[model samples]
Target: MKILLIEDDLDLGNGVRIALADHGFDVVWVRQQEDALRQLDTGACELVLLDLGLPDGDGMRILVRLRHERQNLPVIILSARDALEDRLRGLDGGADDYLVKPFVLAELLSRVKALARRSYGFDGDMLEVRGLTLHVPTRRVMIGERTVELTASEYALLKLLMVRADRVVTRRLLEDEALPGAHENASNALDVHMGNLRRKIGEGFVRTVRGVGYVVDTAAPYKVGE
Candidate 1:
């Protein structure tokens, strides 16, 4: 989904952006509070990763306005602020989740997924079909009797397919959700990722729909010749 990332540090911002992009999020990053406000006011972003410090003003000003205007918007504070009061202030100020600086990229991605899933009435940290399992909190995937490793992008793609099992996930939706905004424009990117995913998980795991999209049919039988 599209995320509004408001971090001012060049190093930190770029790191977060690349990491989130690898995990299949569309990140619209801004360094100043005003720019963040403009993006938020447009109401196009699905989530917010905010930093308390900004060039124009404290990010709290934007957070305050956000709480006032969009009470349901999901905001996660990614900040260097670790004081108890600071954490309390952010949570009390309408932040949905908070992560301190020097955190792991996987944890942040998991939190974003958990919050996004919860918004859609999914309550657990896991999704399972047959013997294939995905532990959302840990970003772990397991087959019936073995564990499988997936790259960040692969995991995102698999999650999208599994969660929407029993239906065809259109190419447009997959491209928008799993690919980085820039890379999604590339013609061969999706095919490459899908190929890698199928190779790792076995071709039986996901079914292609020719021109329509892909499907993870929970009840689909393993083809004899596949």
Candidate 2:
């Protein structure tokens, strides 16, 4: 998952970024609301962890602007304000969830997962592409009864693909999801990860669309190979 963290506190922002990255999420941390708005324009972030107080401007304004433009993007207010009116205003202004300061990282993670599930209608941590199963929480892949172990990058790539199964996911999209708000290392980096994933899963599991991008062949038959 890719997240945009809008927090002015340098230490908190860095800590959240590192923690989320360690938990297999691509996070882009911005200290100011303006930068957060700019990053949102790229349409790469799946979620936003926004602070109500920002250096440049009020984060509520950013939230309002985002809802005015794209109402479906999930935004969770992460701030110190615990007043009932503040929480009410945030929700009324289009925030998906609210988290106060000194919150547990685990709770924040759970909220992100909940938002993803609500957005995609995924019932559990396991993402299903036809018969292939990817357990997101465990980073485990199951092709029938046999299990395939994938590296962290490979797991991340596969999860992204499965979330949008049968859709052509561009290299740019993959790269953005891998490293949010940063320039991609190379054009072939996605290909390398995809190749590694395919080798572990199966040859025909993923398909290349020539100059377009790649797609997971959700209809292909897969079995546990001994």
* Winner by TM-score: 2
TM-score of 2: 0.70
Scanning candidate 1 in windows of ten residues, the lowest lDDT window is 118-127
| C-alpha lDDT score of every prediction, in listed order | 0.81, 0.80
Off by over 4 Å in 1: 121-226
Tens digits of per-residue lDDT, candidate 2, 1-226, equal: 6689999998888888887777666688999977988998887777789999998899999999999987877899999999999999999999999999989887887887788677653433568776788876677889998899887778878887777666677777777766443334445667677887888888777888998778886687456892
RMSD of 1: 8.2
Q: What's the CA RMSD for each of the models?
A: 8.2, 5.4
CA-RMSD of model 2: 5.4
List, residue by residue over 1-226, the lDDT tens digit for candidate 1: 5679999999989988998777656689999988998888766576899999788898888889989998877899998999999999999999999899979987888888888676532223666776788876678898877899999889989888876666677777777767867244668778888999988888677889999889987775766798
Model 2 weakest 10-residue run by lDDT: 178-187
TM-score of each: 0.55, 0.70
What's model 2's lDDT at 159?
81
- The prediction achieving the highest lDDT against the true structure is 1
